[model samples]
Target: MDFKYVPTTCPYCGTGCSFNLVVVDGKVVGTAPFQRSPVNEGRVCPKGSYAHEFVNAPDRLKTPMIKKDGKFVEASWDEALDLVAEKFAQYKGEQSSVICCARASNEDNYALQKFGRCVMQTPNIDHCARLCHASTVAGLAQIFGSGAMTNSVSDLADTNCAFIIGSNNFEAHPLAGRRLMQAKKKGAKIIVCDPRRTPTAKQAHLHIQHYSGTDIALLNGMMQYIIQNGWENKDFIEKRTVGYEEFKKNVMQEKYSLENVSKITGVPVDDIKTACQWIHEAEKTTAVYTLGITQHTVGVDNVRSVGFLQMLTGNMGKPGTGVNPLRGQNNVQGACDMGALPNVFPGYQKVTDEAAVKKFEDAWGCKMPAKIGLTIPEMLDTFADEPEKLKCLYLMGENPIISDPDIAHVDKALKNIEFLVVQDIFLTETAEYADVVLPAVCYAEKDGTQTNTERRVQRWRKAQDGPGESKYDWQIIAELAAKMGMGDKFPWANASEVFDEMAALTPQYCGMNYERIEKEGLQWPCPTCDHPGTKVLHCETFAGMPDGKSVFAPIEHRPPAEQTDADYPFILTTGATIWHWPSGTMTRRSESLNRDCPTGWIEINEEDAAEMGIETGDIVTAYSRRGEVDVPARKTPDIKKGVMFMPFHFWECRANWITNTPYDPVSKTPEYKACAINVKKKEA
Candidate 1:
């Protein structure tokens, strides 16, 4: 038996730290973090350290299969690709859709995008960002020159203060949590403003549990405080930033006063003043947030509100000072950098723009659609009402059944598609309905690049071969292309050539080659052959404006789309547990992870438990207007009263079943955070 240690980035969260899989005798035994890696500093979250076990699980798909008479039967690659070609070829140049994932590596992502655009010829393609940060991207990109992190993780260590809103970093980005703790150790003041008492808030020097969906009120109030105190960095504001006086007049002189903000945000005036003081007086300050800020009816405005506050305080250029959006998945930043969105081409360029479309057309040797594509939520709306309906659905590496906001809608809307193809390593809940299942290689069995939360692209190395008859995704896609007479587009022999093509087409990745990333992974905006790649974007200017000035949009607080009502009197907040990734695709495959925590349970405060006549481990029925599911109740102090938390990793009990299907008007992202539901003791 022989083995090799290959250092690669994680496929889970966005830390992008290097790690090595213990490939013992041509099989991956375990994963260990790179001790010398600077990003993780020789540590990994529980998920990052153990997410490799699923590579060779017993339930892994071992052979390519086609659904014949409603049963998956093993077949040769030629037979499987022929079947896919027959179905997809029928939909070429039709109104079809391609839904991509952030978990996919760089080559895979680029291939999937090109497959949809060149093969399908529809701009109706989008990735998970449509669900997670579509609003955040639209929000921050409007203010900053680029829609990425303005400050890197290293800046957290160098900053004097951090203003966090609408996120639970402790459980979500645990590695970032350690850095937040580091900043606390270095005597940095942390101000957290959220409705829930999250782990990050518990560590904050000051925590303001503001009312849900009142982020704008809290931010506007803080801006007013800074103006009254005259603690703003006036010199930096005047020299670097534009539109200061008008922003001040609107934010400071508006009828929406601090008293009104205190009313809307449900925070004391003094507490708002204190938070404002820390941000205003700090020599260097940075603001950060996650999905909580972006998954809202006013998600776009919520992001701009934060950016406006930061620009007003002069937190843009210097170390420890800027707007940082804590990204969720490993390559979410990369997927966007590759133009996985419907509205934008690669590198965040608008698809409707003639120049951007012309660039992509020239590179791919095909004409692109002039209109932007549909988002997942928009696609859902089409399924909900429209007729021409999305046919021939091809889902790669995403499980919307367990991940989407509304479960009932997912079940019905997915039926609107004519032909369904699911390409993954495991038979995911969504894949259960697939007419064609292609057994594709997992991350450990494939080598490519993954961009982290900070837009840092790092090497993803393969440590083992695909078990049984499974093949790399590139091979599967190429064979399908060949069967459909588009094989010439994918002339590459390996994934490296795919990367070369992606870098050639996408300008942000233009300079990044396999050899370069092998030496040291290059972050996007590497733009040219010799560019070192941008560490922090917009160091000298913001996006949109000619002189690079941030725009301040007028905003106000609104209640969550679905608040606690009489029938369903509790507020349900959904999130992922430490041991579970989205839908538990890889996490559920692990023996240790399952043993640590299994099954979904509604968290009840000790007092709320008593009031509801619910005890620990009591099987209860959680119901809403959309749907219902039964789960045991767990009373814990981690959550506040009247608010129940549930992990969305399990499929048998889909969390989205009970979630409201409220969408943000601007971001079009479903509001998965706040929903009204009732929990009761399950009848015997």
Candidate 2:
């Protein structure tokens, strides 16, 4: 058997760990560690190790399928493209929107947005970022003048102390966890604050189990304590930031008292002081968070609190000293950077900006829409309206049916839409409802660039050919654009040409090209070819603020939309495990991963399990006002009492069935972390 090793980036999480696909006789057989990778350095998580298995899974969609009289029939690319264009032409502006994928490459997403704006002529374009770090992008951009991770992944090694909250980094971002482990090896303090005692928590210098949805209070309390103890960075605050006085007066002094904050957050006053002390004592501290911070009614405020703590500690503009939001999907950051959000064009350029609009219009030779579009939730919600406002939806690599909050509502809305087009490698749950399903290539079949959590744009080389009739997401989109009468506008010869177009428009990626990224990827804000990519942002000044200073917003804590009552007596939180991923569109198809994880299980605190007559391995039914799901109970003390945790990986017992839709006002991110639910033992 002829054997070859192909180096590629992981398609699972935002950590962007690199590995080699082990090919035998022209077939992908397994994965080998890419030891030379700057991100992972040979270490890979369980998912990355088994990533190759899903690329050639038996269930992968091999050809386009169009639904005729409620039955899916295999069709040629021309037939499918003609039908899609015909249906899409019936809708206009707000009525037609495209939901791009977080899993696709940067080139794929950039093309998706370009097609949506120029060909479809709709400002309504968004992605899964609406479900995840939309709050991070919104809140951080307003406060820090930028929205992405402020430091590179490797910078975690230089941290004096790491204050990790809201995320189970070891599970969700394993490569980043490796860097934190390196920091610990060098004696850097690690503090974990979450409602659950995650694997990362167990490794921390301090683990403070705070109440769900009270992150703002907890952070403000710490800031108050630090300021009270004279640990506030007076010099840094005065020189580099704005609105400190308003924040200090309104939040720390007026609203939050150590006693009041402790009472609201359900964390003891002493533990809050201890967390503050660690931050106070450390010279270079990094604040890392994930969905737990963003999936709340106060998500924007929650993110701002993390920013407040870091800025108060003089942590910006340096290595190992900035607030880091570990993104979920591998290319979610890249998707956002490529302008998947409705309100902005690529590189966070506003749709309303006359100059930016004129620039893009000149480049594309088409007038751009000035009005911003609807977010994902808003797009889905529009379908529920009488006479249906949204006529068509073009979804790429996203499974909104399983991933969106309130699946029942999403189901009804999807059914009401006039036409739905889904493009993905697998026959996902969302694809089951599609009027037309376009077969798309998996990462193994595509050569493209993906920006990781660190804003490092790394190239994942094509390892093998895709199965019959399947095309790369970008190719399918470009072909669709061509059919939709935009053939002359999209003249991309290859993925490199697409990247070049994206880099030319997006200032953050101006310096990036396939050539520079081939050897070692560059972190963005690269700007020019002569300029090396930026490692740590805001080294000299914050990005694009009116006064070149970071702003500290005085945010107050808000309770979750739905609180535990006599009917729904438990607080439910959802997340992904190390063995499984969100929606499980890709991971569930993996033989090894499925063998390891098998199915979904709800993590109930031992005390709650006993109270409900539930035991480990016992089937339990968890229901909220929205819907109910039954999964085997996993009795553990890892989670806080009265709080139930489940991973939204398996569709058999979708955790989103019970997740609430109440969103943050500023960011529109659903309050997935603190929904109220009730649980009961299922009779055998």
Candidate 3:
């Protein structure tokens, strides 16, 4: 029996844990711990352990298919590519949009975005980051001149204090949560601010159960108390930051006082003070958060407020300090870095910048569009409201039907499009509406690189051969580019060639090569061949600002787009579970993961469930202004009363069906964390 272990990064959350794929006689069978990996330190979460189960699942898409008579029919790759190319030729400029995938490798995203610009000649390109961390990119860039995590995952162990808010990293990002525990073991204080008493919160030294949509209020209150007690880092603010005078004046207002903030956030004034005191007392305080802070109408404001707090407390630079926004997917950070967004080229070189456009044009031998394109939300809105504006959409490895807010509207937009194409390992709900469906290989069957949440670029080594005619994402894109008459621009022979081409153009990755990161990944800003990767950003000075000093944005708290009222009396929020990842595309395919958490359920406070005569496991219907869903009820005192929690992973009970569509003006991130909803027990 020929057996070998192949090392690759986990394809789940952004924690970037690495494991060895157990291959038995040339087939991937299971996973084993890779002790040398600094990310997970030889330990992995349940999802990582079971990640290989879905790679060779029976339902893997093996052949390309084309729609005929409103039904899918197997076809040769040439036939499907011909049809796609024909359809794509009809839509040009703003009429065409490309939705790249976060699950795909950096090579895949870079190729797709390049194809969109040179072949289709459209600026409409984006991925799931617009929904998850667009605020992190926009908000942090405005403050610190960069939108990525300022500290490495391993740095959490060196923190003196960890101020966690709006994230249940213990479940969503287990490996990252492991780092927080390491800090605790070293006598570090953990302060968690969340509405639910999550496993992470339960382990906190101080848990401030704040109300939903009140992150700004809670943060402002803490800052006000810190300043009132003369704990603010006046030296850092005066030397390393700008706009502190206006920011101080804004937070010192009576509305931000501990008493008013307590009323707004439903967190006790003393608890708020305690949180501030703990942060001030600590030598190094790190602010940690996730979608809970970035999935609201005021997501940018919330993120900026966190940045302001860190800068005010002198936590901008050094180990175990600065703001950390954990990404949701394995390559979501890579997707953004590869310029899969609407407004920027690779390395965040703005499309509007003539110099950046000219550089790319000279490199690719094509005239690129200079105008900013539509984001994901804007693309969907155009599809639903003005179908003619965006006639064709090419989606690769993205399941927007289940992942996007107001999925009902997403369903409509998918159907309304003139031409739709989906490429994935499986026929997702979003692919069911596709005119052409291309089969793509999973991470185990592809050789490429994926950038984790910390800007670390790691290699994804191919462990086994893909089933049937399925091809690598970049290969499929290259083939389509060839058919679309841009073969000269995409002359790369393999993933390495693609990476070399991308690194040459993106300044942050210019120093990295496959050889340098063969065993262990390296973080970004490796600008030279001999330069070591950066672990902590802003070590000496901020990079995002032109003046080498961070700026402050004095923001005020804004209520959620939809408020609780007589019709919808409870606040509804959504998140992921420990056993399953977002949308349940890969996790649900794992028999073990599916068996553990079979379906979705709504978590109602025990008091609220009791008042409604509802029992655990009882069927309940949650109603909002847009839509409603029937799900099993789970009564738990861990959750606050007047608030409902649901995991948006199950299709039978989609939480996004009732999620509000109002998005942040700057980031365009939908308000998935807070909305108005009412729940009632289903009668027999």
Q: What RMSD, rounded to one decimal, does every model reach?
A: 1.9, 1.1, 0.7
**Mind giving the per-residue lDDT tens digits that candidate 3 earns over 1-684?**
999999999999999999999999989999999999888999999999999999999989999999999999999999999999998998878899999999999999999999999899999999999999999999999988888999999998899999998999999999999999999999999999999999999999999988899999999888888899999898998889999988989999999999999899898888988888889889999999999999999999999999999999999789999899999999999999999999999999999999999999999999989989999999999999999788999999988888999988998889999999999999988899999999999999989999998889998999999999999989999999899888888998999999999999999999999999897989998999998899999988897799989998678999999999998999999999999988888999999999999999999999999999999999999989989999999999999889989999999999999998999999999999999999989998
List TM-score per model, in order: 0.96, 0.99, 0.99
Indicate whether candidate 1 or candidate 3 has the larger lDDT.
Answer: 3
Q: Deviation in angstroms for 636 in model 3?
A: 0.7
Which candidate's TM-score is highest? 3
Q: lDDT of candidate 2?
A: 0.90
lDDT of each: 0.79, 0.90, 0.93
Clashing residue pairs in candidate 1, if any?
144-543, 145-542, 145-543
| Tens-digit per-residue lDDT, 119-227, candidate 2 | 8889999999989999999989888889999998899989999999998999889889989989999989999999999998999989989888889888888888898
Worst 10 residues of 1 by lDDT: 381-390
Off by over 4 Å in 2: none
**Steric clash pairs (candidate 2):** none
- Please report the candidate that would top lDDT against the real structure: 3
Give the range where candidate 2 is weakest over 10 consecutive residues by summed lDDT: 380-389
Candidates in descending lDDT order: 3, 2, 1
